[model samples]
Target: MSAIGGPCDRALWYGFRWASPKRFDAATLKRFADGHQTEAVAIARLKACDQLEVYDLSPDTGRQFGFEDHHGHFRGHMDGVILGLLQAPKTWHVLEIKAVSDAKFRELEKAVEKVGEKLALREWSETYYAQAVLYMDYADLDRHYCVVCTPGCRRWMAVRTERDKPEAGRLRGRAQTIIASDSPPPRISEAPDYYQCRWCDHAPVCHQGEQALSHCRTCLHSTPVEGGEWHCARWARKISVEEQREGCPAHLYIPGLVPGEQVDAGPDWVEYRLPDGSVWRDGGAAYTIGDTIEAEAYRHAA
Candidate 1:
């Protein structure tokens, strides 16, 4: 399969709500690796104690649980499952670990005190709640033990969450929607300057009409070969699934890959006519598909 299993909060959240092509910069990648290391350290400390029976799923061959649908296009993986805890009854529970900054931890602490851990988590981040629910459902567990720790602070909190079947079903349906459909879900907002959109890595591509599909697997320049191999038309080279997911700057959306009517085209740029009759320009340096640019500017540029 071209798509790898998504079990983390970020992947699941993006898959279900916004399946934009992810572009992880070096800083983001380093942050992820550091967070994983922090989690490993915390888990190791927990494993050394007698209060809990922790299972490590960080190893490549470790025991993990996952589910696939839509011909393995939609999938999820759990970090690990635990059976013992000092405060809880002896029953299986999903063990989820997260390392947050001290500032975030303080905010979480206040939220936990105000509304309780379960509700606080949902308020703090919907992605975390959705990930927990998916893990519970796929791992056949009814409870979740989410461990949150701060770097350099030995203190940590274990928050318990129960399975929410209704939410899980909704998320599952969303995942299926992404896998079965050609286009990604609508952008969170039409305005390029939207706060969320600004922070998102996919902002450049998601807002641009340069490519019909931002991902390599769906790009026009790429063709899937046997044995899950992909050949790039532009480079005439083989591409791996990992490389496809982390798209390059050279990504060009195939024409008609996006669900829209083409209204204009140039030697390097293509414009899709929007519902409001404004042209969405693709393949330009300053103008992108979803970005709000002046009509006169688009006309002059086109």
Candidate 2:
């Protein structure tokens, strides 16, 4: 219900609808609740910081700064009530909180595109960084903070650049002008493989017959690297279906810990649910719950 700036949620919601209407069943509400819980956790964390102000920039600004990409511009709306806005001397900071899953992150990443265009697909976090960079440009702020809180873990980071950086400032201006225009821009006859019709919400009408998953075929670096692994690229692949499922890895079942206890279960590869609602298969470790399941150990315990 709350609107956050990132396109991760909208991309996931649309993916759910496309994958199967059932994706928005009971689990959806739980996800929403979990999101709020994450926000609360993030707020608490922000309070711990020495200098941070969690306030509403929407009302005072009088204009919503959307993510210039396809989903942010046309399909998605930003979420969360700006956790906090930092101001000092003449500098400003925008704090955006996210309670999103790894898969949603992927969709949001792939959804980035030119201003006022149809949605596409990309990695979620990268897209988030792009959007945040855009926000920095919009607010004319120097640095931005992202506080991401999952069910059992909380992570916060301050992304700063010595300067505005060329693309960051220019993209924001172009997007703002495009958004304020009265008429919408024309559509592309065909999108890139990654931004094809299958995953696109407009796909139903566009009927481009493009498959939703695996847009790498059209990518310039499509060559396969056998036994090739890159440490940096691994982060993007971390959110795959096999790594984020309900009873998958990563999420360890801590016995006796209450739902609100702040416990770090360490890092493990968990199963992830894909955009098409299909659970990724992982032949890795598994986690099980015992009779000691409690609600007090998680970051938020009600």
Candidate 3:
């Protein structure tokens, strides 16, 4: 949901394809933990309110509100749903909870003064605005309620967002188009130092012509199929997420990602000429980069 409506399609494409394994520093991991804690506090506070009926978890499923589409490729779990608000007693509204910095909270306050909270959301963070819009679209609601809390969950503010069907429809099309693509879309910027590219995780592969991490999703043989599943042409089977993460011996690099000249190829195998005239091959019992002793031995064979 967040990636689909982002400004950079190519970055989103790389991420969807598992171009690199997601990594986080300890600080980032701590922040994520803090966010979960904040969400719990917000839920508790919302429940304490007399006028608002907040359902953080589903009575039937015993799980948070979740929505999926596009063969399960596109999905998100909402913070909850709110009803019986003082303003709209009968209508349901999608609920999103986020923890921002005090500075960001103040910025939101100023934004509300200038443009009102709903429209001010775009100025706050396009990613959150996208999530709110998509959540409303999926939950069959006309409005979304975003609760922004400070880092320590000490303060919070609420913003109301209305549904934009035109924008939702546009995002849906964009998501499908991105999913159906066999290649990355045009980059938001071509230069490596461009603001967006510089900070991107996929920059190594996208701009430096480096190889993407070896995974079924990054291989040429793999294709996303129905049922939120992935199919490998070489294996001709629906692969699980675990299997996708640990690709097999016959993995073939998508040619565009090879960073070399193709001189020869065969079924289950591809050969490339390196810049220094070294020859490299992958697949069909070739120099696979998989985590194995053989791969380690042949790491510099090219």
Candidate 4:
């Protein structure tokens, strides 16, 4: 309804923009488009590891995956394997090569899991399995891997399986509801918690960003009492009217994605700057102490 352009809508834009290689190419300068260079580096890394052989899983191989404009409707292409498509005996793994960092690893892991599932459902489950064991219905394979490589750090991690019986049931139920009523998912009695809230594309409906305060693991308001204590209850005070009146920096300022903008994270902070405006988040409230508070005050100042 908001034309998908608002501080709240930035997350939606960020979700689709970076994941598409085409978007990345257009947004970055020619010199910065080091995808090919990274690919060569990753290929060499895989070759040296001797753990897996690589192949490209493009449509030229007679397999269709990834976003597809099906009939008149736009579906997704799920099968463009980014890096080494490997197989060991009966094991199949789709290894994505990324400039590995703690944040990069998390991002890549989510991307692989999300896109792999789409490919598995749209294309042949068996074919997807031969490349990567997609967690469509079960986790039968021992290893579902992605390789993340930075200039200095190369890291690899297996996809952990989740026995999400309730979630699977809900998805199935939603499909049935759509078929029967020609509508979207039904409104439920209870809303999901904020930790799970980030993954929900429709989270804006509930003021989830503010709702997220309750789930913050570290809040200064928390009482530290003992050698070992669960402080969540003490810290769990809901946002008050006075705090709202005071204009919490988090509420007023959110760096939503512009169509062509870049976000970078540094050792101590994350920055988002567009042609119009910029935002910088302090490392954390947990670390700020004494006169260092003045620095944070200035940083959050508009």
List TM-scores for all candidates, in order.
Answer: 0.67, 0.39, 0.89, 0.31
lDDT of 1 by residue, 120-161 (tens): 766666777888887787777898888888863366887888
The true-versus-predicted C-alpha distance at residue 279 of model 4, in Å, is 39
Candidate 4: tens digits of C-alpha lDDT, residues 37-79:
6555665655675555544345466653332111212122222
Give per-residue lDDT, candidate 4, residue 192: 55
> Which candidate number would show the highest lDDT if scored against the true structure?
3
| Candidate 1 regions with alpha-carbon error over 4 angstroms | 1-27, 58-61, 208-216, 220-260, 263-302
Score candidate 4 by lDDT: 0.35
- lDDT of candidate 2 at residue 252, scale 0 to 100: 26
Worst 10 residues of 3 by lDDT: 293-302
Sequence-dependent TM-score of model 3: 0.89
Best by TM-score: 3
After superposition, which runs of candidate 2 have C-alpha atoms over 4 Å from their true positions?
A: 1-26, 50-92, 102-126, 152-165, 168-196, 208-302
Each candidate: RMSD: 9.6, 21.5, 4.8, 20.2
Candidate 2 deviates by what RMSD? 21.5
The Cα local distance difference test for each model comes to 0.64, 0.39, 0.82, 0.35
Pairs with backbone N, CA or C atoms under 3 Å apart (clashes), candidate 3: none
Which model is ahead, 1 or 3, in terms of lDDT?
Answer: 3
Question: For residues 55-121, could you state the per-residue lDDT of candidate 3 as single tens digits?
Answer: 9998889998898888888878888999977667898999889898788899999989999866988
- For residue 176, model 2's alpha carbon misses the true position, in angstroms, by 5.9
Candidate 4: the clashing residue pairs are: 65-78, 65-79, 66-76, 66-77, 66-78, 66-79, 67-76, 67-77, 68-76
